[model samples]
Target: MAEQDTVRVGAFTVGMAEAEGWVRRYFDESRNREVAATGGRTRPYAYPVYDRFAAGGAESELSDGDLLAPSLLNASLGIRAVYNLQTLRPRLEKGLAAIPPTLTLTDAAARGTLASLLTDLFGVLDGPDPAVGLGLTTLSKILHRKRPLMIPLYDRRVKRCYCGDSGDHPVEPVSRSAPDGPFYAAVAAGIARDLAEQPVQWRYLASVAPADVSLLRVFDVVAWERGGTRDA
Candidate 1:
């Protein structure tokens, strides 16, 4: 069997053991409090907007205000970007329409579909620096809320953590130079495998979200905690 620490999905490899350790540490009382302190505060409008979508809300129900709410919230959390809702409205509507409410993480097809969808959305932005255009983190948050179970958040910390890069040498967005379909699929598969193989770890996450916590969300917490500090 392969080592639990090293997970290889296609050409991409992740330090699962390090991520697991962070998850474990994050559950500790003192550590949990410390990490929670650094976490993003809830934006009142954001939750309702997300809840509406999660409850099978139609794409037509989404407005420019709905899309911009999360982006503004992201800016508050220190993920910076300038989004023109008026310009991007049509594209955002198309992208949201592409998302099936029944999407599942366990479905192999979902990853490729999501990656293509993200690429389309990311391509809609007009900016000099692709990195700063739509903002990878902001996009991830939007996707996560849209499909909480299927999409994991991909901020600077999570990207750096997964790529094993230093803050001084941040990695590029997965969609910048190439289609990130395979890469996103690999990550989704890896996280699903980890959760399946480790029931104890999955159970540990119940302390974070008792009733319903997606494995993608668990990975998000681990990545945020680990990446914000240092490489494990």
Candidate 2:
């Protein structure tokens, strides 16, 4: 009998076949789709925006141009629709400026700093303006650009895959007053361990993923593709 090819993802053990299948599916849908399944000009892929952001230099401090990074990736169309750029600018500038440009999820020494940055970013969504559209998903997208090696994208699907939160009872938007640091810190730690423990698996996944994508991003694609339907 053949040994099962698997890797640990947070609390779940995922088969390599399943993970790779999702990665391929994601790329096809994002990169190769000529039309939406529903039929329209296929929405733009986020990678172009990512490339543009990188071209400008992925600095620790937020720049006017860098704001474009988070808005393009997800289904939301754009972050600006929800967040007033002027309202978000100051907080984003201060919060992101504190994060080290070189930080990665695997760095144990920088765990506290990572958590602190997440906590501060989450505040943008929870701040005084109830109309502001920012959420955990957008905050994560922004951080992923700034620290792609360290931050994983955390959309509804990724949340479903990792947290086991299903569509029926969707995860609630986090309150401003909630302590955000510990949860994201734990999430980052689990991903760190997953990447650290499975070198062979990571290498295979990386080799198959789109060039220039970060390890964290490759995992995010795999996890989001899994959704809540499959534990693997």
Candidate 3:
């Protein structure tokens, strides 16, 4: 049979078969062995934040310490503490307030809402020095913790591996010049479509909550793994 044709989802174009292959590769033994070796050191600090929000806590409940700690330790992005939390906290609260309590990724309005929220959040720490602002990787991590299914962690590895030439570089913090909402939305929608069409691949993420394991995370894992191999 001829190779499957490509389909566009947001900013990503992926073949159905190719998407399945990527999903399968994530669950391959060698990959699991490597992930297992790391032993998920960040989960201890991260999962509580997810649980808090999921249990109906307000978005304002998420703190700077809660947001920055995991990213500094687990994201491997070399993020530094430069911004005053007092200055940054209110901006985060406003951005989080803009996000709806429930997000439906399939809806255009919902996607728009998310995109705007990200843009507002990214703009919070815009500064004279690029390195001084909240990094894109850290922003994604904070949003992902708040809504794992809707947001994917965008780091140097994932962007380089999945976003081709259009993706942002790891060194750049998200700003007006490098807004990331649309690209992330596209990738998330593409992954959601793949999972909807092929339920079997969903089984590969059996270890996590069914709600938490969306295409965004799958793509993150695949890209992170590929990027790691290339670095090695």
Candidate 4:
């Protein structure tokens, strides 16, 4: 969003080195330990429905006359959110049946071939909104549903890191609230960039580390980049 916004340079506590070592460590370890869940059956995502997340499933193909169409909303989350082979196959099958059996993939392998396929087809996968679904809740149970793993999930981290205990981290203007971030994205990028440019600890920057995979370390980056106090 604000790529060139005047970065509150000296205010950041965690420097480039800290982010590099921390983030990489956290990501690597999480990836190593946590087996990615198999789509819809996964924990918190289903929590959305339990929380009454009403976003419709992508249209069913073997249903009533006239396909419901492979919605952009369904496509968006299906493509990005469902990363496991077990779940991806079903989504791909549904996508193909409703849209074009040839739309995503016809045959999927169980050992994560679907995730691999989607990764390759990302270019085609990138398209209009399949749907727009948002249910905002900071209720402790809703917010702390799952421990954060590698790759920051954005919002909650933003609230915890930038906003502090209050829950409004690096409060980006409401208008800039997409995943790309007018605020959060910029801050994360800034910190990552600085970490990338660091001269010392070249290997740490080059490779993902074990510690930086979870929020335990992610908060440091979010806090530092979101304009949190350096002294903290």
Candidate 5:
């Protein structure tokens, strides 16, 4: 199929050409990290964390590295100073146990399951204190790492892509202060529909993207790169 083919994903109609462009950009960025590592910079946190978690199997509990991954990815080193791993481990583990390791957000039932999980997990992760407290961006990042096929990353750019109103004026970005479980489910459902309807295209995208990145992440990069600027 030509890259220009468009598919409905979430609230937006995404073009394959555009999606491929953005996903390719994301791959290039991932490659750039390798270059950075050659310059003596520390190894990347994303793939390493993912590989470690996958290697340990679903029966394993979240480790200190799991907590630190999103923290470092978000550039919040201070989280380590106050976040009590012992205090949060049980809750985090409980939440993870409820969601199957191989779950994918690809249907109504799956979307509902994702919503319920996000509702419960978000409550556990978002707090007034900075330690356990994380905004949507960080929270989504953590969940995306844990369930790559199910959760889409929801940073500011992604919010702009899905939450904006159609008008001449710019829409205000959605608040990251709290998690919106329904919104996430909606996004998941849309992506599921796209993938279900466009299997060949999704397979093509998967083939082109980094092996470690999930289909969810592929769509995320597409939306993210296509998403409007914060001020736009």
Candidate 6:
């Protein structure tokens, strides 16, 4: 899609409010309690593991890096018992393992630490699942965690604003070889950075989502809304 043809879409989800709101509500006290009470207790279990893996600490009897830890491997148990991501463990693991085990990003601004980490994970030509690459995975992770992380839309919604449908959730693929299409990830990062009022919290994210995953498809969702901040 041409830059001129693209228009923006307000973030939204479910028919109630913007995607951000939907996310906030989902994470709200009641929902969290409900999910937890009704066997939705995934975050509790996985978070500690995730934290340990992220910090390269001790989660098991062995050293943090001893076996790439279950969290590093994207163990479904974490998603199911802790984060409740409800997707392919390997795919999630790809994203988790792909991230660098650090906080600082080389070009923290252009890609942020975590986002850039995804780039490092998939941008490689010899990487494991070279299909989606780091870009798309990062975008996918951003959208999925936006509500939880509080970052604004990644920008594909903005990129294809008035351009019309490209027959997919994310219009483009993160990388050229990513199994998906468009490079929508490039679109998300590009447009989000162009904005002047982007959220502060999600600024630094080192993430990945294996190869061939659409990032969006991994969560089975799509963006929809009207207008947003014209100033920022």
| Highest TM-score against the true fold, candidate | 2
Rank ordering of all candidates by lDDT, starting from the highest? 2, 5, 1, 3, 6, 4
Model 5 C-alpha lDDT per residue in residues 1-232, reported as the tens digit of each score = 5543864443565677777776675576566567666865554434444334443324427655565556535534345432654466677678767777677767434455656765666555444654444455765665567777666777766666555555421222353333455555554554566677777777777788777777877776666655653442
Instruction: Please report, as a residue range, the 10-residue window in candidate 3 with the lowest summed lDDT.
Output: 42-51
Candidate 1 TM-score over all chains jointly: 0.56
Clash count of each predicted structure:
0, 0, 0, 20, 1, 26
lDDT per model, in order? 0.50, 0.61, 0.49, 0.31, 0.59, 0.32
The alpha-carbon deviation from the true structure for residue 124 of candidate 3, after best TM-score superposition, in angstroms, is 1.7
Scored by lDDT, model 6 comes in at 0.32
Q: Per-candidate TM vs. native? A: 0.56, 0.71, 0.55, 0.27, 0.70, 0.33
What residue pairs are clashing in model 1? none
lDDT of 2 by residue, 18-39 (tens): 8887666555545543444356
Instruction: Decide which is better by lDDT, 2 or 3.
Output: 2
Give the Å error, residue 123, model 1. 3.4
Better of 1 and 3 by TM-score: 1
lDDT over C-alpha atoms for residue 85 of model 3: 39
Q: What is the lDDT of residue 132 in candidate 3?
A: 51
Model 1 agreement with the true structure over 99-215: per-residue lDDT tens digits: 665665555333456446545554554345343445555656655665666666676665554443333322334433443434443444545555555555455553454234455
How far residue 119's Cα lies from its native spot in candidate 2, in Å, is 2.4
Give per-residue CA lDDT, model 4, range 145-215, as digits (tens).
Answer: 12122112233334434333223233344523443223432334333433333324333433453332333
Model 4 steric clash total: 20
Better of 4 and 5 by lDDT: 5
Give residue 34's error in model 3 in angstroms. 13
Q: On residues 1-232, what C-alpha lDDT tens digit does candidate 6 reach at each position?
A: 4432222222221222233343343224455455556784353222223222343322112222422333222322222222222222334445445443332222233455534444443233234534322333333433232122212233333444422344432333324445322343344444344332323212211112223222222122223222233421
- Best first by TM-score, ranked: 2, 5, 1, 3, 6, 4
State residue 221's C-alpha deviation in candidate 4, in Å.
8.4
Model 1 accuracy (lDDT, Cα): 0.50
Q: In model 4, which runs have C-alpha deviations exceeding 4 angstroms? A: 1-130, 134-153, 158-185, 197-202, 205-232
**Pairwise lDDT winner, candidates 4 and 6:** 6
